[model samples]
Target: MKIDWAAIGSVIGVSLSVTVGLVALFTLGIAGLSRRERAAAEGNGGGAIAATGAYVCFAACAAAVAYGIYLIMAKS
Candidate 1:
């Protein structure tokens, strides 16, 4: 039996990074929305920018997920 340590390591690295990256992106989106609400209460007028940032982050996350699903379904 032969073990491909390099391939296994690469897969692990990619999976770990993707998982962590997505989580961080999602967290930032949530934080952005909260910040926008707080800023609105203070009449800071910065909520628009924050809301935009949040939307972009969320869209990117959604795209990544959809692409992943597409790739998986493509394999069949």
Candidate 2:
């Protein structure tokens, strides 16, 4: 069997691009949530719930990206 390096590279590049894009989105979401949380905290309001929810969402996004990368790598 022969390896098609070009195809492999294409798949890897696409997968990485998707992963990075999703991560960027998640980062932006987290950043926005953090800012909101800070504002709420300074206003004498509880922000822990919102902060925790943002962390959970970020983790979920990371997991999804990892799963997508795994699928790409597993493809023949």
Candidate 3:
């Protein structure tokens, strides 16, 4: 059987990029949370914005995971 090297490379590249993107998104969520806490301790109005950003990041990550699961289960 002939190997489809281009298809194999495409899959590998996509997988690695997605993995890195997810990790970076999650890390940003964590960093936003940390900044929120710091702002809260400093008695500033910045915490609210940071908290909102952190929640948005978390939601995006959750949605991405759910979509991935759905794709696997759909098997279409």
| lDDT per residue (tens digit) for residues 1-76 in model 2 | 9999999999899888977877786886687588667878699456666677677778778788689779789995
Q: List the candidates' TM-scores in order.
A: 0.94, 0.54, 0.95
Please tell me which model should have the higher lDDT, number 1 or number 2: 1
Q: What is the C-alpha lDDT of each candidate?
A: 0.95, 0.78, 0.94
Per-residue error for 61 in candidate 1, Å, reads: 0.4
Q: What's the lDDT for residue 5 in model 2?
A: 100
Give the clashing residue pairs of candidate 1, or none: none
Clashes of each: 0, 0, 0
**Superposed model 1: Cα runs more than 4 Å off:** none
TM-score of 1: 0.94
Error of 1 at 4 (Å): 0.8
